[model samples]
Target: MSHSIEITPIDDQCPLLHQTKKDNIEEAGKINGQYTNKSANHIIDEKLKDLDKYTSKKFIAIFKVNVGLRKSNPDAYTPMLISIGPYHKKNPQLGSMEKYKLMYLRRFLQRKRGLDVEHCITEIEKLKGIALKCYDDIENLDNDIVDKFSEILLLDGCFVVEFIRECSGMKPNREDKIISTNCMINLVLRDLLLLENQLPFFVLTKLQYMTKEVDEVPITKLVKETFFSILPKMAHASYLEREGDVKCIKHLLQLVHMSSHPSYYNSLWHVQDLSLKIISKDQDYQTWHANMPNVTELCEAGVRFSKVGNTYSDLEDRTTLFDIKFENGRMRMPCFEVDDVTETLLRNLIAYEQQTCDVLPKHFSDFAVFMDYLID
Candidate 1:
């Protein structure tokens, strides 16, 4: 009985079993395909809905420093002692300056007798939405109610106006800590120049008009004198002198930008000239890596260095910082001064120009790229 047992293979006995298995697999694949198609369609519909709801507006100008730039020098992009806008409003390290802001606000209000704090808050409230739109991330701003946002705008705006006024030789009231402390004032100045720590230009302008004295100096003049005083005497003298109207400025950083290149702000001749020169010469403007020699190498190659008048000179012959000439193996360039605040200052200006300016000549970004070529 044990030797008589024989078993046939299932495939040989019933070939239909293999066909049925194949059919089941194909059916499962078809169902999965339908499900995948439905999912893709749903995703496309959602994206279309988002596109339809999107509205174009110029609400963001100030941006967080790019990670690459920030990684190079974190302190250059950070606000150490003070916060100006919604971006850094909640930074605990900057919390100490809140009291100083209030102190400045009090002095600001006292400038005009019988000017209620509520009045300033109300004025800021009127432009609150527009002001908020001028920032990149507004979740922190929107999370707060109107009252809180208005107070912040009013306080920060007035503090900046008063600080600039005080720095411009308008004696502060009763030895103000911010004005009296040299180290603190320097920190505040650096903080103000930060890209993230900024308010809308219109907000500052509105505050200026409200608190302007009968014979007070213009706000632009005061700001230029106050902020640029820290640099060398000739740092921004020519540019500041040439600037006419600053009402079109967008922020503190933009003000610095215009102060740096007055000719660019007033006219596009320099930009056109640069574009033509680069295009005609077939220079590698697109890539940072080129056959550019560094300062040391150029010196060893029998190139003599002579200092030009200004980094931002508007002479018809020389228009930009990159207007270097190597005539007869001698190089003539505008003297560029580098200092502790230079990186922070330049980084903020570049960020502002890249984000806010509508014009084609991104002079700051272009200059940065040019510098990178030399350094690399």
Candidate 2:
């Protein structure tokens, strides 16, 4: 004999089933009430906590390059020889230079008879609040960050101050390894200009004042003499001389950026307006997809290319490296010597403009995009 089992389905009014449903509903209600009981301001505060960290007035200019921009050329944004600031302080490749930094720090403290490492540390520690705010990613630091950060500011600040001094002809030691050879000096300069490898200008300035080194010379003058000697001129001589307000400069990279900015504001505006005309009103200016005709195409269509010559003759009447113009079927552009140094500098400048798009005009990026169109 075969037996078959009969199944009974759950009924709508089953007491156990009703109790389970009621329990789930009550638990969900409790969870919902926890949120609903919050005041509107409390809800908003919770929502805006992350935004507040970034948008606060205390936040300053230094920022990490966005990953999308950085991934294209990782080496372009990284320091090769020496690390500066807290961003790359722990980079293993940069570890070899820490000894040299310490040596420089020793030399820095010796500049004044009464100056000592303890005093320097104490003074820098005082500026900790201001210095810390100048960089991004401070929240991700470890528990002992206060001590670590203060130490970095001291060493890096001393290294920069001394390095600039040595470069400015202040009688560097004959055996100094960093500036001992031309290759090393160039590498150090390249490393210093990387956006991530920078301390706030104020930290260096304060260190200088504390030691009373180069008291007569402004830090800007020392920087110009040191940095400009190695970097090829990307702007007119007058533009290089037109220093940004020293008080406003954030770091070495920014100072160089400001010095190289094109002086032809009217031309920049005209170019920007021309770009605006090409895009539909609904499209974003940044996302406008139009590209100018390449050089070959323009040449095929009866355009002439000429290099702007004799720019150094009269600095007062010179156009900047970025001042490209087209008129009467002739295209004139400032000549640029393309090489390793130039590429490195341009790449970093473009990266800076890309990362700081909100606060800064895209002068470098626009110049690069124009170049891209011309080249290909």
Candidate 3:
């Protein structure tokens, strides 16, 4: 007896499989159609709705050091002793300075005589919105955030004002531990110059005007002297003594940058067109050449180095660090001493110019690029 078994095709046996696939395809088509039919104008309108909430005034000047740069040298960018602004205010390592800030605040109030602590809080509150706007990462800080921020501004601003006053020889508080010790003062100065450690210039100016006597040295002069005194010997000589009043400085680091290149800050030297000048319009491309060798290679090529005898005052009008002169096969350049503070100072200056964009010229950035090319 022979028996035969019949096998049906999968599709024929299971008709629902085809229907399920067809349903899936139709649903996918509907989703794709919805995406494709979105009009450009409608999409733009939806985007514009978010723009109003994020449309900020250009109050943000200070910025955290970018990750790329910070990765190589984290210590250069981080504050060790104290935090000045909202960015690093919560670091546990810097908590010790908070008490000193309060102490400075009390002294500041004493200097003002009748000005109560509430008055300081109120004044800071008035500018709290504007001050908060000065930071880029304060989006989460709502109007209710004003109270905490106001307290920070009050304490930090008073600390800075008092420190500057003491540094400038206004009156020394012998009992104060921070300003009294030379090492502590130096550390504080370094911390204050960090890129993230900054307060708005106007805030410090307001505090200075409120507390300072009519006959006292202006805050600008005091700041200039204090900063110059703390910098290394080479940077001290590099400072170009300004004749007139100081320009509107944004922070202590800005003051350092301006002091280093006064002509550029004072508008005496405008941004030079750094582009290679075209000799003729007919020339499609300009030939560029730079053979900057290392000191060893340059020595082998019969080049000699000599210290530039010209003082900072002698070359006050020049705007670049590349103020070199080649005479008799010897390259004469200004002497610059690089010490512990040099790296931190330079990194902050470059960070400032990088973030400020249109607010200040990119002198430091240009210098860094120039140096990189030479090193390469």
Q: Which candidate gets the maximum lDDT versus the true structure?
A: 2
| Tens digit per residue, CA lDDT, model 2, 195-255 | 7788999898898777664444877778877776555445446444747467787888888
Kindly indicate the candidate among 2 and 3 with the higher lDDT.
2
The list of candidate 1 runs beyond 4 A from truth reads 1-57, 140-142, 145-147, 172-178, 231-237, 242-245, 262-289, 309-324, 357-360
* Clashes by residue pair, model 1: 59-133, 59-134
Q: Write the per-residue lDDT of candidate 3 for residues 1-376, one digit (tens) a residue.
A: 9999997786575343244675365445455563323454577889899766652747576677888778878899898898998888768999999999988888888886689998988888887777777777666445544458888888999999889887877764555544688778878888888888998877888888888797987777777777764443323334646535543666777777766653234443221222122112233323322433445665776878786533432333342343444556675555555667767877887787777766455656655654564356
In model 1, which range of ten residues has the least summed lDDT? 311-320
TM-score-wise, the better of 1 and 2 is: 2
Candidate 1 residue lDDT tens string, 1-376:
3567588885576443345675365445455463345566777999888764333355566677778667777878889898887777778988888888988888888788889888887788899877766776564455663347778888899899989888887754566545678888888898888888888888988998897888888777787877764542234444457456665677887776666653334553333343324333555444323445666766776668787666432333223444444466675556655667767877777766666648456766766765564466
Better of 1 and 3 by lDDT: 1
User: Which model scores highest in TM-score?
Assistant: 2
- lDDT: worst 10-residue window of model 3: 270-279
Worst 10 residues of 2 by lDDT: 272-281
Task: For candidate 1, give the lDDT of residue 250.
Answer: 74
Report the number of clashing residue pairs per model.
2, 0, 0
After the best TM-score superposition of candidate 1, give how far the Cα of residue 319 lies from its true spot, in angstroms: 12
